[model samples]
Target: MKINVEVDCTPEEARRAVGLPDLTPLHDKYVSMMMETMQGGVPPEMLETMMRSWAPMGEAGMAMWRKLFEGGAKS
Candidate 1:
């Protein structure tokens, strides 16, 4: 025997049902900051430095990124 259940609700409702934190505000802030940076309020080198610092696993993060792209290129 098999049982199936269907849920019909908005994404917010689904998130709430799963007990996930609502990150809409944080996402909006991140998008706003990215737009500001892209509009020349921040220099390219400064953005690169910031991204490198935010990367996981410290310096190895860059190596991992390179490998990821390299694998994509081969396919």
Candidate 2:
């Protein structure tokens, strides 16, 4: 059996249909803050911390992957 469905709608419309909360304002604020940080003096450690917080696996997962890759490379 073969079936196809096509959805043609703007992102906002799709989001609304899906009952997702509108995060446009939050996203815009985050982007604006990033821009300001890049233009101003954002410390490297602060940026690193922020990036780590956003990572789903965080430092432990990244460390495991790094070790696996290094072991494979040595083999």
Candidate 3:
């Protein structure tokens, strides 16, 4: 037997499905700090370390980081 599924759920839904809460605010803060670091003219090595250190704890954090970087790259 084979099982198939179409995952069309938002992060919040996925989190809730497994009993989790929204973490957008936390991600937003990270992005804010990253942007600030850039705007404040922080060094590259320092910024990279800061980003890695501030990375979220799990999948949700990773997803947020990706989105943040994508957006940051564009602007």
Which predicted model would earn the best TM-score? Answer: 2
lDDT values for all models: 0.77, 0.76, 0.75
Worst 10 residues of 2 by lDDT: 64-73
**1 or 3: which has the higher lDDT?**
1
Which 10 residues in a row give candidate 3 its minimum summed lDDT?
Answer: 44-53
Best-first order by TM-score: 2, 1, 3
Question: What lDDT does candidate 1 reach at residue 41?
Answer: 58
Number of the top-ranking candidate, with lDDT as the measure:
1
Off by over 4 Å in 3: 5-7, 48-75
Candidate 1 lDDT for residue 47: 59
Clashing pairs in 1: none
Q: Distance from true position, residue 1, model 2, in Å? A: 3.0
Cα distance off (Å), candidate 1, residue 10: 4.3
Count of clashes, each model? 0, 0, 0
lDDT tens per residue, model 2, 1-75: 999999999999999999999999999999798777766876767766766666578887656655754584487
